[model samples]
Structures are given as C-alpha cells and as structure tokens.
Target chain A: MTAFLIENKYTVGIMLGVIFGLASRILMLRTDYRQYPTYPHGRIIHISLGVIAAALGAVAVPALFNKDYTAITFLTLAAQQFRDVRKMERDTLTKIDELELVQRGTTYIEGIAMVFEGRNYLVIMTAFFSSLFAISFTWYYGLAAGIVSMIIVLALRSGKSISHIASAESVPVKQDGPDLLVGDIYIMNVGLKVNQELIAERGLGVIIKPYNPNGKATLSNLGQRQAILYDLSTILGVYRDDGEPALIPMAKLDMRDGRLAIFLLPQEKNASKAREIVLRVPILESAVRMPTEAKVNQQEGS
Target chain B: MGEIKAVVTMHKQQVGGGAPIFVADNVKQMEETAFLLEKLLDAAVHDLKNGTFILVKHK
Candidate 1:
C-alpha cells in the first residue's frame, strides 16, 4: 500500500493541479476586476498566486518520493506558467474591453462581447495542465490529455459563451458608426448555439403580416409598391401586386424553420435606408366598396 | 490550457469593404511585446477606419 502511494504521488499531484486550475479559471472569470479594480484585482491576484501554489503542490507531492532537483525545476516552470495564465486572462479582458468601448457604447452589443470574453485562459489552461502532466508523468500522456482537455473546453466554452451572449440579444460592436446598420446581425448567445448557418442558409422572409385596414397591403402586393433589401449581398424585387411591397428588405427575410420569422418595417430613424425599410400603410384598393355604418349596426343588432 | 498569451485584434478586408479583426496568441514575449502589440492593433484599427485592411492575424 505504501509503495503504491509513493508510485502514484506525481499522478495524484497532476490531477490535483488540473482540478485547481479549473477552479481558479472559474473564480477569476466570475470576479471581473477591471471596473471594481480594488475588489476584482485582489481576487484575481489571489487566484493568480494560487496557481503557483498549485504548481508547488504538484512538485511537492512527487518530491516526497523522488527527492530530486527535477521536482524543483518543474515547480519553477509551473510557477511561470501560472503567472502567464493570470496575466493573459487579465490583459486580454482589459484590452478588448477598452477597444470595444471606444468603438461602441455599453448599451451596444460590443460591450457584451468585449466583457464576456475567453479563449486566452483556455489556451493557457491547456498548456499549464499539459506541462504539469509531462513533468509529473509521461510526456506523451500529458500532451494527449492536455490537448484533449483543451479542445473539449474550447468547444464547450464556445457554445456556452455564444448562447450567453445571444440571450443578451444585441450586436456587440468592436467598431463604431451607428448601432442600427442595415445588416442582419447573426446572434449566438453562447459559443455552442449559433444562428449563423440557419440565417445564412435560409435567409430572411416575411412571417408577420403587415397591418392594412383594407387588407390590400399583403406580401402579394409587392408588385405594385417599391421595396428593397440590401446587405453584404443584395436581393431586390418588386411587389407582385399582392399587397406585398415591391422590395423586401433582406433583413426581413428569414429561414422558414420554426426557429425564426422575418418581416418588414418602415425605416427607423437613424437607421440606413439600404438596410432599413420604411413601412407604409397600404392605401385601400379603389375597387373595394365599404359597407355603410347603418348596415353594420343593423347586422350587429340582429 | 494555459492562460492566453495575448489577445490582439486584427483587420481583414472583405469584398465589400473591410472589418476589424481578432487575433489571439499563446506565446510569451518580452516587455517590448506590449508596445509592438499596441502598434499593430493601432495600425489595424486605422486600416479598419480607412477601409483598407484586408486581413490581419497572429503570425
């Protein structure tokens, strides 16, 4: 039993480091420090320092048996790795947020994108864990595990992040001009769930019917009225006389799946004309006769 | 995964005009690295504003 423990000390230590690394990442992410510098930075620094502690733990666990300078060397390397991870996480978030904010306001989607950032931490985590593995155990095993974990985490986080962002329901701008550009912004809440393929594949289409008192402004009337839809690409067509406007804004067209619906609206103030539609109430068909109020009242009485 | 070494935004030109870029790397650098990064990013942003940058990424 004692022998088994001795042999497995390094393995145990590496596992512990993995667990510690995961926890630290989560904590650092949760405690965003840039805004509340004192409080956030304190928490982040603690975690950053904790990473070194974790590396020491890895080295010490094996050192109990090996009792060599090798463990000491690894401890040094791991400490550096930990420091790198901490700095990366902090710097990336800070720089990205600064640039994004300069480009767009907090209310814009750019703020959310800039703020809810990741990727750097993920890469560092993979490297740190793998290094721990290689130093503690076989290099190949460590590399394999580290690579696998990194890929999995990246995939998972991407989906998760994307969905989270999407739920926020706004386009994050990294560059600025206007918030309401004449383009369809693909929304993904977390990294996992994305509407890119769906939006691109299906395209926008009329779903909600526009209101018209005489019922003359249905999508079919596009032949009679003028309408246009533009984007990175262009789609232009005239209304076919069915009450649908002649030009449907590409943004208004959406994939037919139950997931999304598309429709047109009048150009909102400040929005680009090429991208935005100016919704207009349709004039009543000249041929349609209106019933007299007296007749309607009589029908209601009966 | 190690922490991100650096997160740099780049710019890439598309058919229509151009767009700002995002480039992330995991390599460590010396003190001058930060200054170099700033220069690169600033240049990219300039291109984005001017509609000239075609593509930018971590080499």
Candidate 2:
C-alpha cells in the first residue's frame, strides 16, 4: 500500500486538493440572520456546485502534468458557470425583494450576487494552489498551502460596513403637529393623531454623520440610503406591518449638509442597538460614489 | 411604460386610517409631494399602465 502511494503521489495530491477545496467552500457557505441560501435545498444547491468546482480545480494539476493543456479551458467554462450562479442569485433576490417588508435595494442585491460569484473563484484558487504545491513539492506543502488559502478565504468573506466610513448617533424623534421630524430632518406627516402619539412613544431616530467627503457622497445615493433603512429594519425588526404606510422606516438626507436622518419605529426600542446596526450596515458597491476623487470636484475644492 | 400623464390634485384636509394623502395643484407640485412621500414615507410611485401613478409604501 505504501509503495502504491509513493508511486502515485500526484493522484494523492489531487485527492487532498479536492477535499481542501470543498472544505473551503463549506467553510464560506453560511445561512446567516438574513436566512439567505436557505436551509436544506438552498445549501444543497451551493454545496453541489462547490463539489463540482473542487473536482475541476483538483483535476487541472494532473491534466497539466500529463501535458493536457486543453484542461485550462475548463477553468474558463467554470468561470462562466459561476457567473450564471451569480445571475441566478440576483434574479432570485430581485424577485424576493419585491415581497420584502423593507426591500434590499438593487445595489445591495447586486453586491450580494457579486460576492457569491467571487467566492467561487476563490474556491477554485484554493484548490488549484493546493494541487500545485503538492504536485511540485510534497503532500505536506499542499496541506500548508490549503490552510493558508482557507485563511485568505475567511479574510475575504465579508466587505466593509458603513461604520468604516461614517459614525451613527441616536437622536431625538420630535413631532410638531402632524410633521414627524428626526433631528430637524422632516420625516413625514402622521395625519392621524393616534399614530402621531404612537410615533412619539415608540419611534427611534438616528443621525449618521459622514467622516469625510467620500462618506458624504456615498450617503447621498438613494440606493445607499435605502440599503441603510433595509439593514436597520431587518436587524431591529420593523414596528409596522404590510400596508401601514405611516410606520415604514425612512432614511432622508439633509441635502444641505449631506447628513442622513433615519426614522424608525422598532419592535426593539434599543437606541444603541439601532445605532450599531446603522453603523454596521454594509455600503453597497453600486451605491458608492467618490465625488472627491473626481477632477471637477478637486478643481472646485482648490 | 409610456410617457407619464400629468394629473395633479391637492388635498388640504387629512385623510383617515394612516393612508398617504397627497395634495398637489400641478405636475411640479405633484412631483414635490411625491419626493416628500418618497423621503418621508419611503413610498414608491408605480405607473399603473392606466395613465395613473400609484404611490405604494412597503413596510
């Protein structure tokens, strides 16, 4: 048995690479608070794709060793397949967003889809690297490379949040007659006196102050603002049900100063937690705007 | 979606049951009201293909 293993070390290397690649994919796959990639079925689909990715990655090294250069083309095909996975996720999420109480905007949906697609490439890289190291050096080197790749995968899992760019503070939710205001930012008019009273009693307000021009520009995007509201509603629990127009959480920009004022009636009235959620809201890739970096803005600044 | 037909009406008195009540005299005013509703109430204006815009707010 030991002699057989020694003679066919490349085969053993490929097997180990496939295992590590699958492990990396499994490690990255999680159904979190959002309940995305939902239980059994959703998870099964992704896992099956991960297995295919792992197999493809593992076989490439052996194929290359035997001078089968055409095996490299399979990687391109795998990439196209992964892009389709991204499209599937986007289409699914867009359809689901239509039914959400607080909809994740297009920017957020796109960001999620992009991440899903990118992670598959990471899986392929992890498998390819492990296979390469094992075939070129030793089996132990492959194990080391796999571990390192897994760490890289873990590090790249999540993107930066709003807190990285701005600061969020709890503010007073003030009512004057029918006008609902969050820190002088007019939220809405609660025509019903009873609803006004409920808002006065239960509403939580937050003001997000951007630290720099970049943050300010990002906050200006309607999609980013909507993303903030969605994240807040998702985490803290929206106070209102479907068709209750008055109770919908809103994020409005203080157009003059670029400050964002958010008004929400939360099931959980913890102001600090709400603020934390606001700060932790991921900045949507599509909604990110860097006016500060633009030549026109720079010229005006100087 | 076709070119949006302009039909603007303004309501001075408050409507009942927490439903959004918009009052505007012209297209500009209607747009302003719609903007306020969007920012303040998080309502979306959907064109119904019947030459009318329905402002719907999702919780």
Candidate 3:
C-alpha cells in the first residue's frame, strides 16, 4: 500500500473515500434499522448491502486513486448494492393492507421506509459510491459528483410518490362517520372552583348562589332526566322544575375527549342577547366506535 | 382527591344477544374510557368477523 501510494500521490484521496463510505454505512445501519424492524429479513438485506458497498469502496476507491483495477469490479458492486437496497423497499410492504391497495394494514414495512424517505437512503448510498468515482477520475470527479447529485434530486421526487402510496397503504382510515346519540344527557358536577353570586328569584331574598368561577366547571348533584336522555340524539331539551322546556344546543359533543357540553338558552335570545345557561349534559356511553369519524361530516369549507 | 376536580362512573348495558356491554361515563373519564371501549370493540368486531365471537366468554 505504501509502494502504491508512492507510485501515485492521489492514492491518499482513496483513504478519505474509504473512511467516508464506512462512516456513512455505519451511521445508516445504526439509525435506520430501528425505524422499521418488523421485517427482520429486509434488515439483513440492507445491512449486507451496506457492508458490500463499503468493502467495494475500500478497494476500488484506493485502486482507482492509484489508477489500477483490471476490471471496474468495485463500481459494479456498489451499483448492485444500491439496486438491491431499492428493491428491498418493496419487500418491506409485503403485508397487504386491503384488496384495493389503499386500505390500512397493521404490519406495513414499505410504508415505514417511505415515511423515513427512501431517497435519503439512496443519497447515502450515492455518497458512499461517490468516493469510488473520485478515485477513478480525479479531474472528472466533479462531473461524477454532479451526476449522482442529479440522481438524488430525481430520487426525492420519486420518494414523494412513494410516500403518497405508502401513506394510503399504512393509515387506518374509516369510511363511515362517528355514532353520536344526543339526548337525555344530564350534566354532572365534578367539582371545579366555586364563587359566590347574588341570587334573585323574583320575590326571593339576596340568597348567595354557589357559582363556578371558571368556565371549566362541572354540574353538582346532577342526575339525568331519563325521559329526555333516552330519546335524545343531538339536541338537549332543558326543562325547568315545572317541566317547561328550554332549548339548548350542544356546542361540543365528544365522548373520548370528555362528555358533551351543551350551551342552553331561550329560543328567542339572539347572539347578542343570549344569557349563559349551563346544564348537566348526559354522559355518552362509550359503545360507539370510530370517534374520529365525526369530523368527516363537518363542513370542509371552514 | 385534593379538591375533587372530577368524578366519573361507568354505566354498563347488555346488548346484542351476548353480554357485550356499553360504558357510560362523565367528561373527565370520557376520553380514556372511550379509547378503551374502542379497543374492546375492535377485538369484538374481529372476533365477530372471524366467527370466533362465540368462543370467548363475556367479561
């Protein structure tokens, strides 16, 4: 090796190439494998390819710097590794999501690689390969570098297409909307902060009413209005002690995040005139599946 | 327990010929309770689809 370096001073550059190639491969193996480990078989393929790539770069890069190589075996090996890495990507998605190719699948490996960006893998491979090219033609290394850079640019665009397909294959999307039954909902008070408020009930004295100081308050000692709850679907019908109905529209209804909250007031009150009326909203039974489906029916224009 | 920020309870109902039950809870417990229910439903649906729903006893 010393004799070879003495014969050609450029051989020193080949050492740098070998060092960079091995470093890139080690970095990729250490970081990338964890992101997609479901396909242990694919992991083996990628690692072996990286090893072969680094080894080929080690020999070819120095030989090329020394202006040797009876046959461009290292270049050929590097290309083969890149090609295999590209092919391994498809094997990762062996688990079929759906018959239509757009449904969700639990054990999707290709989708995982796509999420991490396949082109980045290619760019890393090309960076390793570039060291070999640098050894071959010291003057034309600039041109070789530009060519690989173009491939990286092109791979990025292809990665986007892969991402679209992979995302469609991986994500579990439901077609139907959420099951929301709004009625007979009673609000229960889970104690929040309380404050004193002057109460005036027509002829009644200035009795102090326990008011929840923050809007983040729950109803206290509340029981469900059974007759109303059983029949309710979306609208909460608030009634006074005398059974007089007050219209309350549910402002937010989500069971997973919390129980539904309804803003109630008289039907005659407009936006400016509406007074704050809080009611015990009914606790939603968590039987309904696909809660996120509710947002699908909402106005898209908003 | 400090100041009683919230209290939640589940309401169970038997339905669909099996002892498949539904849980009702207040807002504080709604989110987590619903997620658990969704998981249960997923298993139930999988069982029903595969004709294994009969093999498992009700909880």
In terms of lDDT, which candidate is strongest? 2
Supply candidate 2's per-residue lDDT for A301.
Answer: 90
How displaced is residue A70 in candidate 2, in Å?
A: 1.2
Distance (Å) between predicted and true CA of A237, model 1?
A: 14
Off by over 4 Å in 3: A1-11, A28-34, A37-48, A57-70, A73-108, A111-302, B1-59
Q: Which ten residues in a row have the lowest lDDT in candidate 2 chain A?
A: A188-197
On DockQ, the stronger of 1 and 3 is 3
Clashing pairs in 2: A101-B59, B9-B24, B10-B23, B10-B24, B11-B23
| Winning model by TM-score | 2
lDDT per residue as tens, model 3, A116-177: 33433443445445555555545246236635554554544322211111110111111111
lDDT of each: 0.35, 0.80, 0.32
* Window of ten residues with lowest summed lDDT in model 3 chain A: A194-203
**Candidate 2 C-alpha lDDT tens digits along A1-302:** 75665677789778878888899999999987778898989999988899889888888998899899998899999999999999999999999999998888888889889988888888888898898898887787888999999999999887788998899999999987667899989876654444677899999999999988899999888888888888888788888876466677888888888899999988899999999898888888887878788999899999
Cα-lDDT of candidate 1: 0.35
Q: How far is candidate 2 from the true structure (C-alpha RMSD, Å)?
A: 7.4
Compute the interface RMSD for each candidate structure: 18.4, 10.5, 16.9
- Model 3 has fnat of 0.00
TM-score rank order: 2, 3, 1
